[model samples]
Target chain A: MSECTKLEMKDLLPDLARGALAGPALAALEDHLATCASCRAELELVRAAQTVLGATPSVDTARIAAAVGRSSSIRRDATVAVAQARRRRAWSVAAPSRRVWLAAASIVAAVGVSVIASNTTRSPVEPGPAPTVAQVEQPSTPGPTTPEPTRPAAPRSTGRAELVMAGGVSDLADADLESLLRVLDDVDTELDVEPAVLLPVLEGDV
Target chain B: MTEPTRDGEPSDAALIARWRGGDERAATILVERHAPAVSRFVASMGERGEVEEVVQDTFVRAFGSLDRFREASSLRTWLFSIARNLCRDRARANRRAPTVVAIDETHLLSSSDPLSAAVATETESRLRAAMERLTETQRAVFTLRVAEGWSYREIADVVETTEGAARVHYHNAVRLVKEYLDE
Candidate 1:
C-alpha cells in the first residue's frame, strides 16, 4: 500500500481531517500529500467516516440526564421510606393497637362482673371456719337450702340446749346448726364417758 | 487537542467538580457534550439497535464511579473506554457471533451540516459497510482515531492496547476500507 515512499505521513491524515495538524505538522502533511495518492484516498475514507458519524442518530441528552438525576432521588426516597416503615414497626411493638387494648379490657370486666355476681348470689361458701359451739347455738333462721331444718332429734335434754342458752353470736350461718348440735351432744357424752375410748376411734379415722 | 466548547463553556473537569458538589445541572451539560461522540464510537464498533442504550450505560457507570475517575483525563476517551467494555460484555453475554448491522439513513437524528446529510448518506453507508468488515479492534481504533479525532494514545487507552498497536490497526483499517470500497 505504500505506493508513495512516505507511508508514515499517512498517520497524520486523521489530524489533517480534524484540523488538528498545525505549523510544522500541517506543512509536512501537505508536502507529503502532494505526491501520495494512497494517503489521499485514505484521507477521503476517514472524512467519509466522520460524515457518517455526524449524520448518525444521536441519543437524547435530556433523557440520559433525567435518568442520572432520578437515581439520586430514588435512593433518597427509598432510605426515607425504609426508615418510616421501621418506625411504624417499632411503635406497633411498643404499644399494642387500640382494638387489642379494648379486647383485653372487656375480658377483665367480664371476669370481675362474674366474680361479684357469684359472691353475692351464692352463700359465702368460703370454707366457714370451724364455728365454736357457742357461735352455732343461736336458734336463728332456718338454713338457706333446707328452708326449715327439723330439730336435730338428738338430746334436747343435753347441755347442748344450754349451748343455745349461751348468748347468740352474730353472723352465724344456719347451715351449720344441725351439725353443730350433733357434734356438741356427742362431745358432751364423750366427756361424760371417757376420753380414752374416743381417742382410739379418732385415731382410726386419721 | 481536547478543549472547551467554542462558546467558552465549562470544561469536563469543571462539570465533574460541580456534579461532585451536588450541582446536578453540570451532569446534564457533560452528557450533552460527550454522548454524541460516545454514540458514534459504539455504533462504529458493530453495536446496532442498542447504540443509545450502550451510551446511556457508559455514562451511568462513569458517573457511578466518578469518585475514582481522574479529573485530569479526557472524559470523552474515558467514555469510549467504558462503551468498549460494555459492548464486549454484551457480546460475551449474548454468546453469539458478532454481526455487522447496516447503518440506516432514516435513523439519522441531528446533523451539523445539512448539506453533508443530503449529499453523503449513500457514501456514508458505503464507508460504514467497509468499516464493519474490519475486525472489532481495528474498527474501534479507526473510529476513535479518525471519526472522534482522538490521538493514538487515547485510542490505545480505550481499546486496551499500546499506542503502537493502535497505529497499526488504523493503518490496516484504512487499507481494508480502501480495498472494500474499490470492490
Candidate 2:
C-alpha cells in the first residue's frame, strides 16, 4: 500500500473528524491513519482540542435581553432628541431672516408714505416732529386751485407689492412702524418731489 | 434545511424587517436571539469580565447602523465581526494587549465521577492555557474553527484574510496547541 503524504493526511484530518470524507478517499485516509502513529496522535489531539474549546460557557439569556432592551431604548431616545434639536436649529435660523425681510418691507412702505406726506404738505426739509397717525392718514385731494407738484415720472414698483402679498403687513409691530417712518424722514433731503407726487397718481390710476 | 429558529420564530432578516417597520417585539426577538452568541464569541476572543457590556455595545452599534447593512453576509457573521472589532477597540483603549490567560474550564467539563471530573477540568485548563499562548489571530481562528465549527472560508471572511492564510493559521495554531499539551 502506498503511504499518503503527511501534508495530505493532515489536510484530511479535519474533514475526517467531521465525517466529511467518503468512498475511496475515506478508505485511503483510514488505511494511512491506521499505519501512522503520528497521524493518529495528531487526530486525537485535534479531537481533544475541539472538545475543550467547544465547552465555551453559555451566557445568561435573560440578562442579555434586559441589557439590550435598555440600550435600544436609550438609542431611540437619543435619535428622537437629535431630530428635535435639528428642527429647533432650523427654526432658529429661519425666524430671524423672516423678521429681517418683514422689517425691510415696512421701511419701504414707510418711505413711500413719507414721500406722499411731503408732497401733500409741501413741508420744508426740516427735522420736524413726527406726523400724528391721523395727519398721516388724512387724504389730500389735489385741490382745484393748488398747483400739482412738478413731480418726475415714477419708477417701477420694485416688486414691493408682491412682497406685501406674500408676507402680510399686519404682522408688523407698532414700534417697527414708528422706526421706519423716522428713517424715511431722515432721508427726506435726498427725496425727489416729482416721483413722490407721481406715486399717488400711479396708485390712483391703478 | 431551513435554519431553525427558537420555537418557530422568524429569521433574522424577517425580524429586521419587522423592527424597521416599527414593531418593537421584533427588536426584542433579534436581541434575545443573537446576544448570547455574541457574548460567547466575545468571551472566546479573550474579552473577560464585561462580556455583557461589550455585547450590548455591539448590538447598539449594529442597530444604529442597520440601514448600512447590505445583508451580503449572514447576520451571525456580521455580529461576530462587530464583536471582534469592539474587543480590539477595548483592548486598545485599556492600553493592554490581548494575553491568553487560563479560561475557566469548569463549565466545559462534566462527569458523574469526581475523579473523571477533576481530570477533565485539569485537561481543559491546560488546553486553555496553551490557547492563551497563541497570538490573537491564531486564537480567534482556532476558536472559531473548533468551538464555532465555522468553515475555513467563513473564518477567512470574518477575520478578513484569504482562505489560504486562515488554513495556515489554523494548522500552525493546532500544531502549537498539540506541542503545548505534549509538554
Candidate 3:
C-alpha cells in the first residue's frame, strides 16, 4: 500500500529512524510505512540495528590517555637520540677544504718537477748520447715556460696548510668561546642570587 | 565541581598556550578530551588492539606540529584527520579481520556478554564487521557519519574526499550495513 518504493527508503530509512526527516518527507514516510507491511518491518529492523550499533562499547578513556602519555614519552626520547646520532655522523665526514688543498698540493708538486727538469736542460752538464734530463723529467713536468715551480710550490703548500690550520683553530676557538660564555652566564645567574639575611649581621660584627 | 579554566570549552589556542607554558596537566587534559572520540572512530573501524596506540600517535603528532595547524578548520577536525590517517594505516596493514558468522554465534555468545554480546542484540559489532569489508574511504565516511555523527561536508574535509563522494559513500555504506544486518 506504500506509495514510496523500497529502493528510495534504502538510505532514508536510517535518517528517518534517526528522526532527521521533517514536514512532507516525514509524512510521506509515515504514510508509506502505514500501508506497506514489508517497509514497516524493514524500518523496525533498521531501528533495531541502529540501537545495537549505537550500543557499541565506549572506549576506556583512562586506558587511552595513559597510552598516549606513554607514547609521547617514547617519541620524545627517540627524537633526541636520533638528533644526537646525526650530529655525530656529520662531524666525522672529512672537511671539504682538506680535499681541495690535497688536490692543489698535487698540482704544485707536478709544476715543481717541470721547473727542475727545465733548469737541468739549460745547465752546462755534459752527457753522452743518453736521454736529456728534460726528457727524463718530461712525465713529471707541469709544462714549459712555467718558472720557479719549486719556489711557488713551497709557499702554496705552506699557505694551504696554514689555511687548514686556521680553519681548525677557529672552529676550536668557537667551541671554547661558547663554553666560556655558558660558564660566564651560569656565574652571572649565580651572582644574581639574593644574599642571606645573616650576611649583613655578620658583616656588621653583631 | 571544578569548572574549566574558561567557559564553553576552551579554544584550541588557549589549550595550546597552556600546553606550551609547561603545563603537563594541560597536555593530559587535551589528550583526555580528544582521545575518546579518536579512539571511538578507530575502534569503530574494528581496530581494537592498536586503537590506543593510534589515538596516542594522533595527539603526539598533532601537538608536535601544533605550529603548523593554521586553524583553517576546527582543532577537532584536524585531530580527526590525523586519527583517520592513522586508522587507514592500520587497516592497510591487515586487509581483513575475522568476522563472527551466523554459524559462529555460539563461539561469540559463549565468550562475551550474554545480553549485549548476543549476535543480533546490537548492530554495532555487525556494522563494524560490515565496515571492515568496505574500502577505507567508505568505512571512514561511515564511521564519521554513523559513529561520530559528523555531517557529510565535515566527513569530506576530515577524510579529504569530496562532499559529493562522502554523501555517496555514506549512502552506500548505510545500504551495505543494512543489507548485512538484515541478513
Candidate 2 RMSD to the correct structure: 14.6
TM-score of 2: 0.64
Chain A TM-score of each model, in the order shown? 0.35, 0.43, 0.46
Estimate, for each residue in A69-117, the C-alpha lDDT of model 1 and write its tens digit: 7754554455455556556555545444443564455445444444443
All models: lDDT?
A: 0.68, 0.67, 0.59
Writing each residue's lDDT as its tens digit, candidate 3 over A30-122 gives: 887777786776676556545533433455556655654564465455556555544544533333344356445545544454444444433
Worst ten-residue run, lDDT, model 1 chain B? B101-110
Predicted complex 3: DockQ: 0.19
TM-score of 1: 0.60
**CA displacement after TM-score superposition, residue B160 of candidate 1 (Å):** 1.4
Please name the candidate that would achieve the greatest DockQ relative to the true structure. 2
Model 3, chain B only, scores a TM-score of 0.77
Residue-by-residue lDDT tens digits, candidate 2, B45-150: 7776778778877876677567767776677777777888888888786656545544565467678999998887787778878987898789888877766667
DockQ of all candidates, in order?
A: 0.21, 0.31, 0.19
Q: How well does each candidate superpose onto the true structure, as a TM-score?
A: 0.60, 0.64, 0.55
